[model samples]
Target: MAVTRQSVEQFDLDLSELHNDSTTVRFYGDYEEFEEPVQRRGKQTAAMRQGHSKDHRPDLKQLLYILTVSEDGGVPVYFTTDDGDKHDDQTHIPTWDLLKELTGRTDFLYIADCKLASSENLAHLHRQKGRFITILPKNRSEPRKMRQLLTDDPDCVSWKTLYEIRDEDGNLEHRFRTPREEEMTKDGYRLIWIHSLVKETTDEASRMKAIGKTTSELSRFRARLRSPRTLMRQRHRVQEEVEAILAKRPVGSFLSVEVIQEEEVTLKQATPGRRSKKTQYTKETKLRFDLSWKIDADALEVAKRSDGIFPLITNDSKLSAEDVLRAYKRQPIIEKRFSQLKTDSCVAPVYLKEVSRIESLLCVYFLALVIQTLIEREIRRAMDSSGIESVPLYPEGRACRRPTTRRLIDALSSLSHHRLQTDDGDTLSLYTQPTSLQSQLIKLMGLRPSSYGRKKN
Candidate 1:
């Protein structure tokens, strides 16, 4: 809290907009003590139980690392550790309340993912006069209604370009459009639907890929059914296997499966010897199951209509659609902070078993993140002030417009200082000279070149 307040005062951070997001930090130990929250210094420690593992390692125990960063410079201002089994939607109200206490304001736009779009979370924030922007989860009926509206009358949505990006030659790379008339969610919060052309292409390609893979698997299954030595004979078992295949991928909505049953008759010699015309044989009937599938044209059409569509719900009616879109677009800034926490800071793979110690280590990691982001923000601010478009931070002297704190530290990692003591009791220190790029980086970070290798007090 002290560090965040100091940073906010020193940097004059724009607190009007804050982006919040969470990532899971997996632990490799039993963490039996943390199966339930442990009381430490009169506060409950986060339980490292299993939940939705963002790291895709559900077998390992984890703790949810929730971080909220200011829009200015993506500086992390508030963070907390949550029980691993707790759903994100349940954390928003408390997180928002903490932010309100921290910033002493309720009007800041608290942006997060679809988890923040829950009716309880949104209603709580709305009633408190708090503003927010978040993606509407696809499970919601609003998206389906919108898709149906679009399918029935394609001209109903009057789209205006909300955001776009273009290459140097002015060729459009990506474009986002929003309806001129903003819709409202069923809960009466403002709904801004965005359509992305790039996302549309991506969604279509992904659907085709999933469909192709699914069909390929089904075709192989069919071939197996045709084989004389195959064991897949039960209709229910074949249907279950087909359903599992479809469930493995998201193509179930676009494909239909039918289990075809066939009757086969075979003659077996009554005796164990080789078959012969004189030998009496018994005829047996067996049922065989085969699978056949085709794309559901109606479902495919409906999915296509909603390919690039996504909705954003917010309580602030005064903000323009473009502004709302822009705020939500910055949501990825918090994701970058998460990347730093996991990769650059190496906050995971914790060896500590004590929950309190783990929590303390996380606090240190949070402090490190703050300092790292501040350094990055300062360097970028300097670059902008000096009109320096790009720095030679990448290997092979490639220009990098936005330098990361990790890359900056890596650039200076090779610098070394040596000290020697002579027999006569005279001591001398030698320091490695900084490269021109290193010197420029040091200067940009507001440090004097002469003081590059000086020891800190």
Candidate 2:
């Protein structure tokens, strides 16, 4: 079952101890797969009104996923689904509401990617007394104007920042809002064009590669020459290939040939005594093979400046520019979480056939992720203490990382060993003491055996 409000409200009680006015919360979403199943348009497929299954590809719809995270890039899965309406934020309103409740705070940055960065989602965030930083969609017609208003114009340079704290009951809580800085951080966004950089980088790299290839060919031509005729043929071939370079297809598609059958083919003068005929087949076929080559150009170069780098849109006021950039980079953490949830967790191969059961399994995996995160955090803590401070027990966000919860729980279960006593009064070892991980978990959970003993009878 999807986690209910009660479950989130319970977590909020524990969360209250950790967060304060200086903290920032975030949320993000990513599309795991671009295409969804599309039903075959055949008359029979349509007439039956049957849906698609995992074994088949049907009318693929978009999966609008939602993830909420702490300031530290720890992701808490919120929602994942293919909304038939193709709506973005509205598709997960309940989940978002549950998140606010889970966080136990109304004023926090609910970071998300471009898709969830819709006007509706922003408005929803505002309506809930929350804030978010999201990369605006370049497709928005007025975004260029927004960018100019924020980054280009003289007035846009007049940016200001302020921090504030508010009293809630007896506790002092931080409430950061850039009602003015919204033009820059939360709402003000500029579309950065990297296409020029990409093109220039590509051109320079191509030129250098061409020069290297020509030099290499010349060296090979000079070295391969055994007789005067071989030298002439190699020289001529090099020049022809060099001239055709510009018009030639990419290296992967470059033409290569060997004459198979040609009656006019000239055999070596020495071979004339042994062979009456040497045939060369002239048949040719165009084939595109996958080839690997490196360009001396910087590997960081992109075909389009905007191809990989994303637009920086924000409304965060208190955070410095460096922090803002770092915050934006945390978007990918959600993606890794989604991937882990679906793959290692095997959430998709949900045994329950019912859709609700599938959703329930999604929730179970999400909780498992939470447990995994806590386990990793504790493991990292131990590793840090043991002087392996720079290392992680398990790679975080590793695509190939297995279900950490299973491994961690198994480790924990194995830690508290128990051995039965013999009947002959020979003492046998009983349960072993809790390991550092178990103790860390106990401390983490604030568990108390004494308190349990005092419970109502």
Candidate 3:
């Protein structure tokens, strides 16, 4: 489907990250769930049950907004909450535990936004400390620790590290580290921050565009934190404040607190070498060289590029700033999964009610998504022109963004109605090929004849 391939490339499914080359993954999910209006005829009291407000067959119902996540991107994954209101006295699931359980494999790194930016999550991460990159919230006490790191003081310098790792082809991976500085802002929020990284986030072209500040994507990243919703909430509150201000002018004063952060990192380079960040383009266009050599042997360091930014907190000794940012950026993939389920899968615009039914459908939605993901990747890799003869069972471009549930169910499985003539003169539809879609669905179930009678001659 157009939807499936459009946004998923950002997920970073390269085989190198997988332990078994088929190992399961645990990443991140960002989504929102809203209430559906009840549709029913006028007041037999039936209309009231659907959440309709009017006696005239209620058309609308109460709305509950949900923001949730999933682990392993599969059916068995449980509904997870980052943070939300609790109607009853119920304990909510935490991100750390859910990840540990969903991924039987421990090699995966879990990524999340600021909601998981609590001391609890960080402490537990240090304990089990599986691998993670979480954005530190400004409210955290970390600012004190990094206080000396963010300054123009003469003593401030960059920290750097270099490692020798092999590529999938056994080739050497030239990796180096550097401190990253950024100023982040949105509608009503701003953060000054610094992070660490190695290598480029994308190819040379992308690197240049970001550097030139010509990329909308990068611009948005710098601007998205202060969402429109935050403004809306504040505006709504202000309306009430204005009413009070008008009723009793200056009787009481309201002060707005602006949380401003100044972040700087004093990178103490662990390595001794001249810094030459790999130059992107080659003079010949074919033969590329590390164009810029470390002009100064001093440790590679960068200062805050903008005024305010939020730093990504990490305890990973193995990954560099580049690695951390790249992993964090890849989080959009998990979000794409939700988009697929809602649009291509058509699961969100549902007709069901009752929290239990909604939950069950969520289960079905995830299962279908997993099948679609696997099928999609398999099809692309098992190219039709290979020594293998059969075409991909997944079939290329199956859905636009994601496959519809009905379409995906059909792709992963198929059903047939059969009737047999009996002495009782009865006929019934017989279903076949239950669980018929494994790696064998196409091999065993394709192109079968449907004739039951022999020639009368």
Which prediction has the highest TM-score against the true structure? 1
Best by lDDT: 1
Q: Write the per-residue lDDT of candidate 2 for residues 39-90, one digit (tens) a residue.
A: 4333111011112322243333222334454544253534444433344445
lDDT of each: 0.89, 0.43, 0.39
- lDDT score, candidate 3: 0.39
**On lDDT, who's better, 1 or 3?**
1
User: What value of lDDT does candidate 2 attain over all alpha carbons?
Assistant: 0.43
Residue 206 in model 3: lDDT: 39
Q: Which lDDT tens digits does candidate 1 get at residues 98-187?
A: 999889899998999999988899889999999999999888999989988997877878889977899999999999999888878889
Model 1 alpha-carbon drift over 4 Å, by segment: 274-277, 297-299, 453-457
Q: How do the residues 153-207 of candidate 3 rate in per-residue lDDT, one tens digit apiece?
A: 5235353443345789998655443343432222111232443222333332333
Please give the ranking of all candidate structures by lDDT, highest first, separated by commas: 1, 2, 3
* Deviation of model 1 at 201, angstroms: 1.3
Which regions of candidate 3 are displaced past 4 Å? 1-95, 102-107, 141-177, 180-310, 383-457
